[model samples]
Target: MDRVCDGIAVITEGKKGSWVCDGMTVRKVVINPVKAVDTTGAGDAYGSGFVAGLIKRPGDIDYALRLASINSASVVQQIGAKHGLILRALPQGKKWMHIKVEKY
Candidate 1:
Protein backbone atom coordinates (compact mmCIF):
# COMPACT_ATOMS: atom_id res chain seq x y z
CA MET A 1 0.00 0.00 0.00
CA ASP A 2 1.10 3.60 -0.74
CA ARG A 3 -0.19 7.07 -0.04
CA VAL A 4 0.74 9.97 -2.29
CA CYS A 5 0.87 12.91 0.06
CA ASP A 6 2.72 15.51 -2.01
CA GLY A 7 4.98 14.31 -4.82
CA ILE A 8 6.73 11.12 -3.83
CA ALA A 9 6.81 7.51 -4.87
CA VAL A 10 6.26 5.56 -1.67
CA ILE A 11 6.35 1.83 -2.24
CA THR A 12 5.92 -0.87 0.34
CA GLU A 13 6.85 -4.31 -0.82
CA GLY A 14 6.28 -6.11 2.51
CA LYS A 15 5.92 -5.41 6.17
CA LYS A 16 9.62 -4.60 6.55
CA GLY A 17 10.29 -3.36 3.04
CA SER A 18 9.48 0.26 2.19
CA TRP A 19 10.91 3.11 0.14
CA VAL A 20 10.05 6.72 -0.61
CA CYS A 21 11.40 8.77 -3.49
CA ASP A 22 10.45 11.14 -6.27
CA GLY A 23 7.67 9.72 -8.42
CA MET A 24 8.91 11.49 -11.57
CA THR A 25 11.54 8.85 -12.27
CA VAL A 26 12.15 5.36 -10.96
CA ARG A 27 13.59 2.08 -12.15
CA LYS A 28 12.06 -1.24 -11.09
CA VAL A 29 14.08 -4.43 -11.42
CA VAL A 30 12.78 -7.82 -10.24
CA ILE A 31 15.24 -10.49 -9.14
CA ASN A 32 14.79 -13.87 -10.78
CA PRO A 33 14.98 -16.92 -8.57
CA VAL A 34 17.55 -19.62 -9.30
CA LYS A 35 16.34 -23.19 -9.82
CA ALA A 36 17.81 -25.90 -7.59
CA VAL A 37 17.53 -28.69 -10.16
CA ASP A 38 19.66 -26.68 -12.64
CA THR A 39 17.71 -28.09 -15.59
CA THR A 40 17.46 -24.55 -17.01
CA GLY A 41 16.56 -20.96 -16.26
CA ALA A 42 12.88 -21.22 -17.09
CA GLY A 43 11.56 -18.24 -15.12
CA ASP A 44 14.17 -15.85 -16.45
CA ALA A 45 13.70 -17.23 -19.96
CA TYR A 46 9.94 -16.76 -19.73
CA GLY A 47 10.34 -13.16 -18.55
CA SER A 48 12.67 -12.37 -21.42
CA GLY A 49 10.32 -14.04 -23.92
CA PHE A 50 7.37 -12.05 -22.57
CA VAL A 51 9.38 -8.84 -22.89
CA ALA A 52 10.19 -9.71 -26.48
CA GLY A 53 6.51 -10.24 -27.24
CA LEU A 54 5.67 -6.86 -25.71
CA ILE A 55 8.36 -5.18 -27.77
CA LYS A 56 7.30 -6.88 -30.99
CA ARG A 57 3.63 -5.91 -30.53
CA PRO A 58 3.42 -2.78 -28.46
CA GLY A 59 0.21 -1.75 -26.63
CA ASP A 60 -1.10 -5.34 -26.67
CA ILE A 61 -1.24 -5.90 -22.92
CA ASP A 62 -3.71 -8.79 -23.18
CA TYR A 63 -1.51 -10.68 -25.62
CA ALA A 64 1.57 -10.03 -23.55
CA LEU A 65 -0.18 -11.26 -20.39
CA ARG A 66 -1.31 -14.43 -22.16
CA LEU A 67 2.18 -15.11 -23.43
CA ALA A 68 3.62 -14.73 -19.94
CA SER A 69 0.92 -16.92 -18.37
CA ILE A 70 1.40 -19.70 -20.90
CA ASN A 71 5.16 -19.64 -20.48
CA SER A 72 4.87 -19.87 -16.69
CA ALA A 73 2.33 -22.68 -16.87
CA SER A 74 4.55 -24.70 -19.18
CA VAL A 75 7.50 -24.29 -16.84
CA VAL A 76 5.74 -25.77 -13.79
CA GLN A 77 4.39 -28.77 -15.67
CA GLN A 78 7.76 -30.56 -15.74
CA ILE A 79 10.07 -31.76 -12.97
CA GLY A 80 12.61 -29.13 -13.93
CA ALA A 81 11.56 -25.59 -14.80
CA LYS A 82 13.02 -25.68 -18.31
CA HIS A 83 12.68 -29.39 -19.01
CA GLY A 84 10.32 -30.39 -21.84
CA LEU A 85 9.58 -26.76 -22.68
CA ILE A 86 7.60 -26.12 -25.85
CA LEU A 87 7.02 -22.92 -27.73
CA ARG A 88 4.18 -22.77 -30.26
CA ALA A 89 3.48 -19.95 -32.66
CA LEU A 90 -0.06 -18.65 -33.03
CA PRO A 91 -1.97 -20.15 -35.98
CA GLN A 92 -1.89 -17.87 -39.03
CA GLY A 93 -5.58 -18.24 -39.93
CA LYS A 94 -7.02 -18.27 -36.40
CA LYS A 95 -7.83 -15.04 -34.60
CA TRP A 96 -8.10 -16.91 -31.26
CA MET A 97 -6.68 -20.20 -30.07
CA HIS A 98 -8.88 -22.89 -28.59
CA ILE A 99 -8.13 -23.72 -24.94
CA LYS A 100 -9.61 -26.72 -23.11
CA VAL A 101 -11.67 -25.80 -20.09
CA GLU A 102 -11.02 -27.97 -17.02
CA LYS A 103 -13.14 -28.25 -13.93
CA TYR A 104 -11.21 -28.34 -10.68
Candidate 2:
Protein backbone atom coordinates (compact mmCIF):
# COMPACT_ATOMS: atom_id res chain seq x y z
CA MET A 1 0.00 0.00 0.00
CA ASP A 2 2.78 2.37 0.89
CA ARG A 3 4.65 1.79 -2.34
CA VAL A 4 1.64 2.41 -4.51
CA CYS A 5 -0.34 5.44 -3.35
CA ASP A 6 0.39 8.24 -0.92
CA GLY A 7 -3.15 8.42 0.40
CA ILE A 8 -5.37 6.00 2.25
CA ALA A 9 -5.98 2.49 1.02
CA VAL A 10 -8.69 0.28 2.44
CA ILE A 11 -9.74 -3.35 2.13
CA THR A 12 -13.07 -4.52 3.52
CA GLU A 13 -13.31 -8.19 4.52
CA GLY A 14 -16.86 -8.47 5.77
CA LYS A 15 -17.21 -10.27 9.14
CA LYS A 16 -13.53 -11.15 9.31
CA GLY A 17 -12.44 -7.50 9.47
CA SER A 18 -11.07 -4.64 7.37
CA TRP A 19 -7.65 -3.13 6.79
CA VAL A 20 -6.46 0.41 6.15
CA CYS A 21 -3.11 1.73 5.07
CA ASP A 22 -2.07 5.36 4.81
CA GLY A 23 1.36 4.99 3.16
CA MET A 24 2.74 4.41 6.62
CA THR A 25 1.04 2.46 9.37
CA VAL A 26 -1.59 -0.19 8.85
CA ARG A 27 -4.61 -0.63 11.05
CA LYS A 28 -7.01 -3.52 11.41
CA VAL A 29 -10.69 -2.95 12.01
CA VAL A 30 -12.51 -5.65 13.90
CA ILE A 31 -16.14 -5.36 12.92
CA ASN A 32 -18.97 -6.36 15.19
CA PRO A 33 -20.89 -9.48 14.29
CA VAL A 34 -24.24 -9.21 12.53
CA LYS A 35 -26.58 -11.83 11.09
CA ALA A 36 -26.65 -10.84 7.46
CA VAL A 37 -29.74 -11.59 5.43
CA ASP A 38 -28.48 -9.70 2.41
CA THR A 39 -25.18 -8.15 1.40
CA THR A 40 -26.23 -6.26 -1.67
CA GLY A 41 -25.33 -2.72 -0.68
CA ALA A 42 -22.65 -3.41 1.88
CA GLY A 43 -19.82 -2.01 -0.21
CA ASP A 44 -21.69 1.11 -1.17
CA ALA A 45 -22.68 1.73 2.44
CA TYR A 46 -19.11 1.35 3.62
CA GLY A 47 -17.73 3.61 0.91
CA SER A 48 -20.17 6.37 1.67
CA GLY A 49 -19.61 6.11 5.38
CA PHE A 50 -15.84 6.15 4.99
CA VAL A 51 -15.95 9.20 2.76
CA ALA A 52 -18.35 10.96 5.08
CA GLY A 53 -16.03 10.33 7.99
CA LEU A 54 -13.08 11.75 6.08
CA ILE A 55 -15.08 14.87 5.32
CA LYS A 56 -16.40 15.12 8.88
CA ARG A 57 -13.01 14.62 10.50
CA PRO A 58 -9.96 15.01 8.35
CA GLY A 59 -7.01 12.68 9.03
CA ASP A 60 -9.18 10.55 11.30
CA ILE A 61 -8.76 7.22 9.60
CA ASP A 62 -10.10 5.31 12.57
CA TYR A 63 -13.38 7.20 12.53
CA ALA A 64 -13.73 6.64 8.81
CA LEU A 65 -13.13 2.90 9.16
CA ARG A 66 -15.55 2.59 12.06
CA LEU A 67 -18.31 4.45 10.29
CA ALA A 68 -17.74 2.38 7.17
CA SER A 69 -17.90 -0.84 9.14
CA ILE A 70 -21.06 0.22 10.92
CA ASN A 71 -22.74 1.31 7.74
CA SER A 72 -21.86 -1.92 5.96
CA ALA A 73 -22.98 -4.05 8.89
CA SER A 74 -26.38 -2.36 8.99
CA VAL A 75 -27.02 -3.02 5.31
CA VAL A 76 -26.46 -6.74 5.69
CA GLN A 77 -29.03 -7.17 8.43
CA GLN A 78 -32.08 -6.70 6.22
CA ILE A 79 -33.40 -8.52 3.19
CA GLY A 80 -32.76 -5.71 0.73
CA ALA A 81 -29.62 -3.70 0.02
CA LYS A 82 -30.93 -0.35 1.20
CA HIS A 83 -33.60 -1.40 3.64
CA GLY A 84 -31.36 -1.65 6.67
CA LEU A 85 -29.39 1.48 5.87
CA ILE A 86 -29.35 4.29 8.41
CA LEU A 87 -31.00 7.52 7.35
CA ARG A 88 -29.90 9.80 10.17
CA ALA A 89 -27.19 9.85 12.85
CA LEU A 90 -25.32 6.94 14.30
CA PRO A 91 -27.50 4.02 15.26
CA GLN A 92 -28.69 3.67 18.83
CA GLY A 93 -28.41 0.57 21.08
CA LYS A 94 -26.08 -2.32 21.68
CA LYS A 95 -26.40 -3.76 18.20
CA TRP A 96 -25.07 -0.52 16.73
CA MET A 97 -21.92 -0.23 18.73
CA HIS A 98 -18.65 1.24 17.44
CA ILE A 99 -16.00 -0.88 15.74
CA LYS A 100 -12.91 -2.10 17.52
CA VAL A 101 -9.61 -1.38 15.76
CA GLU A 102 -6.02 -2.44 16.38
CA LYS A 103 -2.83 -0.94 15.01
CA TYR A 104 -0.58 -3.38 13.20
Candidate 3:
Protein backbone atom coordinates (compact mmCIF):
# COMPACT_ATOMS: atom_id res chain seq x y z
CA MET A 1 0.00 0.00 0.00
CA ASP A 2 1.11 3.56 -0.83
CA ARG A 3 0.07 4.98 2.49
CA VAL A 4 3.45 6.45 3.25
CA CYS A 5 3.50 10.21 2.99
CA ASP A 6 6.84 11.66 4.09
CA GLY A 7 8.14 8.33 5.34
CA ILE A 8 6.91 4.81 5.96
CA ALA A 9 7.37 2.15 8.56
CA VAL A 10 6.94 -1.51 7.77
CA ILE A 11 5.93 -3.67 10.69
CA THR A 12 7.45 -7.11 10.49
CA GLU A 13 5.56 -9.75 12.39
CA GLY A 14 7.38 -12.86 13.60
CA LYS A 15 10.54 -11.37 12.22
CA LYS A 16 13.73 -9.98 13.73
CA GLY A 17 13.07 -6.33 12.97
CA SER A 18 11.03 -3.54 11.45
CA TRP A 19 11.98 -0.77 9.02
CA VAL A 20 11.32 2.87 8.23
CA CYS A 21 11.76 4.68 4.95
CA ASP A 22 11.99 8.38 4.25
CA GLY A 23 12.04 8.08 0.45
CA MET A 24 15.69 9.12 0.44
CA THR A 25 16.79 6.66 3.07
CA VAL A 26 15.72 3.42 4.66
CA ARG A 27 16.53 2.35 8.19
CA LYS A 28 16.06 -1.10 9.60
CA VAL A 29 15.43 -1.24 13.33
CA VAL A 30 16.01 -4.31 15.43
CA ILE A 31 13.31 -5.20 17.88
CA ASN A 32 13.69 -7.45 20.91
CA PRO A 33 11.92 -10.73 20.32
CA VAL A 34 8.73 -11.28 22.20
CA LYS A 35 5.75 -13.64 22.03
CA ALA A 36 2.70 -11.73 20.92
CA VAL A 37 -0.54 -12.65 22.60
CA ASP A 38 -2.71 -10.39 20.44
CA THR A 39 -2.08 -7.90 17.66
CA THR A 40 -5.26 -5.93 17.93
CA GLY A 41 -3.45 -2.73 18.92
CA ALA A 42 0.02 -2.94 17.48
CA GLY A 43 -0.59 -0.24 14.89
CA ASP A 44 -2.01 2.18 17.42
CA ALA A 45 0.85 1.44 19.72
CA TYR A 46 3.33 2.23 16.98
CA GLY A 47 1.58 5.44 16.04
CA SER A 48 1.47 6.57 19.61
CA GLY A 49 5.14 5.88 20.10
CA PHE A 50 6.09 7.59 16.86
CA VAL A 51 4.10 10.68 17.72
CA ALA A 52 5.51 10.71 21.19
CA GLY A 53 8.97 10.58 19.74
CA LEU A 54 8.19 13.38 17.32
CA ILE A 55 6.85 15.52 20.11
CA LYS A 56 9.84 14.84 22.27
CA ARG A 57 12.41 15.00 19.53
CA PRO A 58 11.13 17.38 16.89
CA GLY A 59 13.40 16.45 13.98
CA ASP A 60 14.56 12.94 14.72
CA ILE A 61 12.74 10.46 12.54
CA ASP A 62 14.93 7.60 13.70
CA TYR A 63 13.94 8.26 17.28
CA ALA A 64 10.31 8.30 16.25
CA LEU A 65 10.61 4.95 14.53
CA ARG A 66 12.42 3.45 17.48
CA LEU A 67 9.76 4.71 19.86
CA ALA A 68 7.10 3.32 17.58
CA SER A 69 8.79 -0.05 17.55
CA ILE A 70 9.16 -0.07 21.31
CA ASN A 71 5.54 0.87 21.81
CA SER A 72 4.29 -1.71 19.35
CA ALA A 73 6.39 -4.37 20.99
CA SER A 74 4.93 -3.53 24.39
CA VAL A 75 1.38 -3.61 23.02
CA VAL A 76 1.53 -6.99 21.34
CA GLN A 77 2.87 -8.56 24.50
CA GLN A 78 -0.43 -7.87 26.18
CA ILE A 79 -3.91 -9.00 25.16
CA GLY A 80 -5.24 -5.52 24.35
CA ALA A 81 -3.90 -2.29 22.89
CA LYS A 82 -4.49 -0.04 25.87
CA HIS A 83 -3.71 -2.71 28.39
CA GLY A 84 0.00 -2.89 27.64
CA LEU A 85 0.42 0.75 26.75
CA ILE A 86 3.33 2.43 28.50
CA LEU A 87 1.69 5.71 29.45
CA ARG A 88 4.72 7.05 31.28
CA ALA A 89 8.32 5.99 31.58
CA LEU A 90 9.93 3.24 29.52
CA PRO A 91 10.53 -0.35 30.56
CA GLN A 92 12.72 -1.33 33.51
CA GLY A 93 15.99 0.63 33.61
CA LYS A 94 15.33 1.83 30.10
CA LYS A 95 16.39 5.37 29.31
CA TRP A 96 14.93 7.54 26.60
CA MET A 97 17.42 8.51 23.94
CA HIS A 98 15.38 11.58 23.15
CA ILE A 99 14.05 14.04 25.65
CA LYS A 100 11.48 12.32 27.81
CA VAL A 101 8.03 13.83 27.57
CA GLU A 102 7.16 15.54 30.78
CA LYS A 103 3.54 16.13 31.74
CA TYR A 104 2.83 19.72 32.50
Model 3: per-residue lDDT, tens digit, 1-104?
A: 23556555455443356656656666666666678999888887888888898899997877887777778877888887688887877767554344232211
lDDT of 1 at 53: 53
lDDT of each: 0.42, 0.84, 0.69
**Per-residue lDDT value at 104 in model 3:** 15
Regarding lDDT, does 1 or 2 come out ahead?
2
Model 1 — TM-score against the truth? 0.41
lDDT of 2 at 88: 65
Question: Quick one: RMSD of model 2?
Answer: 1.6
RMSD of 3: 6.9
Worst 10 residues of 2 by lDDT: 90-99
lDDT preference between candidates 2 and 3, better one: 2
Question: Would you give me the overall lDDT of model 3?
Answer: 0.69
TM-score of 2: 0.90
Per-residue lDDT of 1 in model 3: 20
**The candidate that achieves the highest lDDT relative to the unseen native structure:** 2
- What root-mean-square deviation over C-alphas does model 1 reach? 11.0
Clashing pairs in 1: none
Number of the predicted model whose TM-score against the real structure is largest: 2
